[model samples]
Target chain A: MDADKHFIVGVFDDEEVLLKGIGKIRGNGVKIHDVYSPFPVHGIDDALSIKRSRLPIAAFMFGMTGTALALLMQIWMLGYDWPMIIGGKNHASLPPFIPVTFELTVLLAALGMVGTFFIASDMKPYKWPRQFDLRSTEDKHVMAIDLAINSGKTKDELRSLLRDSGASEVNEKSFE
Target chain B: MQVASSLREALITGGKTVKDVSHDISRHVENKPTKLWWAAMAISVAVMAYGFYCLCYLLWEGVGVWGLNKTVGWAWDITNFVWWVGIGHAGTLISAILLLFRQRWRMSINRAAEAMTIFAVICAATFPFAHMGRLWLGFYWVFPLPNTWGSLWANFNSPLLWDVFAISTYFTVSLVFWYMGLIPDFAVIRDRAVVQGAKIRAQVYNALSFGWQGGAKTWMRYESVALILAGLSTPLVLSVHTIVSMDFATSVIPGWHTTIFPPYFVAGAIFSGFAMVLTLLLITRKVFKLEDYITIYHIELMNIIIIITGSIVGIAYITELFIAWYSGVEYEGYAFYNRVSGPFAWSYWSMMTCNVISPQLFWVKKIRTSLVATFVLSIVVNIGMWFERFVIIVTSLHRDYIPSSWTMFSPTMYDIGEYLFTFGFFFTAFLLFAKFFPVINMAEVKSIVKVASLEKKENASH
Candidate 1:
């Protein structure tokens, strides 16, 4: 295995332990590469100091785009291009246009946010994700420490630190 | 950590650990289809085949094959359209509305409910498309696309045009929401498949999950995206049925032209939607042996929603009558009077009894909690809601100001067949989903188990 690709992985069976272990492991001068679990462990982000996601901001921008596009489309189509009188109403009535506008706004916001999430998280079809431990997707919470990042400590030192911080098992992983 | 009040009832019972949740939910997906599942699939497929035949024959014969006359142009088609759309509401309501309220009980049931919504919307869209009689050629005409026909855009001022946008957007957004939730659960299945040496299952689920790794950063983004989607869907679901109601409310017809249609229709949609949810969940829990996850307490809470919405619908019905009488408008008065005592008074009374009266029985703790009663009453509520739509469309149109064009509307065999086709499609899709996909939101449900289970907390502390 490449020296740079070496990692010390800790497996946790309990969410509470994993959460507290995040802080304890980091406190011992070990930088966590990532923590993987079967479900979203509440407050794990704060524990890992992961920044809050900007997905909602992206959703809002997309929603605004939808609103503008919808209004422009309706106004351009009914007002300028081929206006027809249906209910003795105006050519481009705003009230009648609201439903479609609302629908499009929601549509764009949802789809856009989902797309952004996939991109931001690097999630996509056929993308083989790096599973430090497959059990991380099951009952175990797996925390990975990059050996290169924590070169100050030996492998044995990191492994014992993980075990002391509530890890049931500590394993070494490396990738080319 | 979320700590449920000591006094609160446990959301997940049967003393489930994280491993048990994964095992219990994924086993259904990982294992071969049970004999009951095969039997259900066979029946649904047979119905779908028959319905497909009817749809083909209808397409070949044209709109004249149905009993649509000049007066009652909108009968079963519109009724079924509204009914299916209304049924679609509960999924988003549970996933979105209840989510905003932070109701943890929704975790177990939202997956199936949202799937039902997708299927129901597909069923709803069938009516308007099939009613067009030449859907193959004219389907694209609904969209405001730049066409060859002189750039003659679809009428923006028309509710019919607005419906096209509304339903399509609603379906797309709901599908995205449902699929997003399924990703993490799919990852769970995929990981289990790897351990069990099920290569095909692992590959399929991995692709379906879009290679979700469940990393802390990814999960943080996933949660934010989910929350925003839920916020978007809440208003989107309400707007969908409100626009559907506008199809009638915006019209000048005596019975149809009521300002109360929007709120009333939305309430009725939720009422019928909850009934449908109850109908599906009760069977799902029993068939999948998920009794512990979807406990009787969940049923009781759902029943309470049914009571609230049902009473609202009942009040709307009465208020419509009172307003007709109070307005002193002969046409409006005659419309309500005819609805009560007219030739089709049977449907009106059926609507009242089934939707208004039957759900009220849920007030009795015994009836509401009993699986048999909820199952039976849920079907009753759906049938009544169907009649409610039928009575509104057919009765209102059957008697116009001019007696010459006024005529009774009756459904041909094709009408009934088209409806069966939708049922077949819905059940077939749902069964396939239940068999293959995780029927419960395993990820979400797992998140709550530690907090929701008092025993687990106690055990942990010990």
Candidate 2:
């Protein structure tokens, strides 16, 4: 592993219980490393106070880029380079340009946004991720709290806090 | 939190927990392939092999091996192309369009629909590529790449060129959107594999999943990107079939030159698309024992869409006929007349019955909800849509302005083989998808597990 961290992880079977537990844990001002759920639990993001994403803005910019590139390529090709008069239609026209323009616009937007998402999520193909709890991907939701960052509470205190809040299992996890 | 209410139906039934949803959906992936899976795959490969043989012979013997003649240039190949493209449309509509609309019922079906979209596009693309006798050069020529022939650019005005761009764009977008949706679910499967001590499965799914940490921050971005992609794909879906329709509508041919082709083709695309989805889902649901997730509610909702689109197609057909007679052009009028009374009258009636009359059966509650009825009608609708394309392409061309060049088309064995080959290819790909990946969008299904209304009720009661 390129990086390592010590963490206290809590696993909960029920989403409702998990939500309540998240609220309780976050209420104490304990910094949460991350919570992994099999599904996107409603209100979990708000509970964790995660920041709103800026991906939509990225998508718009990418889309604009696509539109500009499409128009530029078409104008360069049809208007200046190898312009032909077929069926008496205009060599550099607007209607015929729309389809290709639309296609390129969509293609670039999709590709660009996906690229942006991978960057934003730190979801590179080569990165080896640390797993806090394997069951987090199965039936349980996992909440991992970094032990090294929190100086106020002892490990036992956080472990009891996890147990009191309905965690099925509270375990210490480390990635080396 | 969601209770199955009269007004707001639960998207997933059996009141499944998130784990149960994961387990239920992932069971197929973790276990070895079933006997039925093997049998179906075997048949698909055999059919595909035959189709491949036909394609090889086509390459060897040339385009003349098919029944295409001077007058009727585009026949079974283009018709199959359009048919398959139309089938691909329902997938995007289910995923992108329905997502935009917030139709929760799409959760269970969207995965299969999107997969169908990819496979169907693959099938649809084979025609135009193979139709080019010089498949090698013609494929490259269709693209607007700058080459040694620097001054020679692809004709911007050509619908075929537009189609080349449209199909590829549609394929790429759909692939991204579908794969993006799969990432989180892949992580879920990966976690399970690790627990089971399956080293290879864990590593493969781990990499495949992009090491998704399920962080709230990551999910938010995943969601935002999904919405944006959906927005991009919605217009894209409409444009794709519209460009396909333009291949005919832009022409001077009597039956083909109609302003209504875009909406008509789009409507028919959705119609056949839903039918094909239904056809496949019915088999998939039963074979996989996924009745709880893919409930009658989902089937009926899809059936309702089929009815609506089918009627739109029917109205378009009548409207085209009305315009043909209403337009006083002899060529257009005779073209409509020829479709009804030509050598292809059977194809025309089949189109009418399958596309129009048959889907009307879906209007009935019992028939629409009935699995057998939906399955048969779905296949029937597809057959109708195919013949509909045949009637439009062949009828107009067989007896156009130049009567001397008018000729009836009869498909050679290779044409039938090529069409069967697509069926083989489509099923083989789809079955492999079903076997390997989570068929239902597990993450999405988990999202809808708690109904908003039920949550509201619980809060109020509290």
Please report the candidate that would top TM-score against the real structure: 1
Q: Which DockQ values do the candidates obtain, in the order shown? A: 0.88, 0.70
lDDT of 2 by residue, A1-176 (tens): 12238888998877789889988987887888888877777677788887788887777788889889888888888888888887888878888888998899889888998998998778865565788877776667888988887757899999999999899999999876
The CAPRI class of candidate 2 is medium
Q: In model 2, where do residues sit more than 4 Å from their true spots?
A: A1-4, B1-6, B452-462
TM-scores of the candidates in the order shown = 0.98, 0.96
lDDT of 2 by residue, B272-342 (tens): 99999999999999999999899998999999999999999999999999999998998999999999988
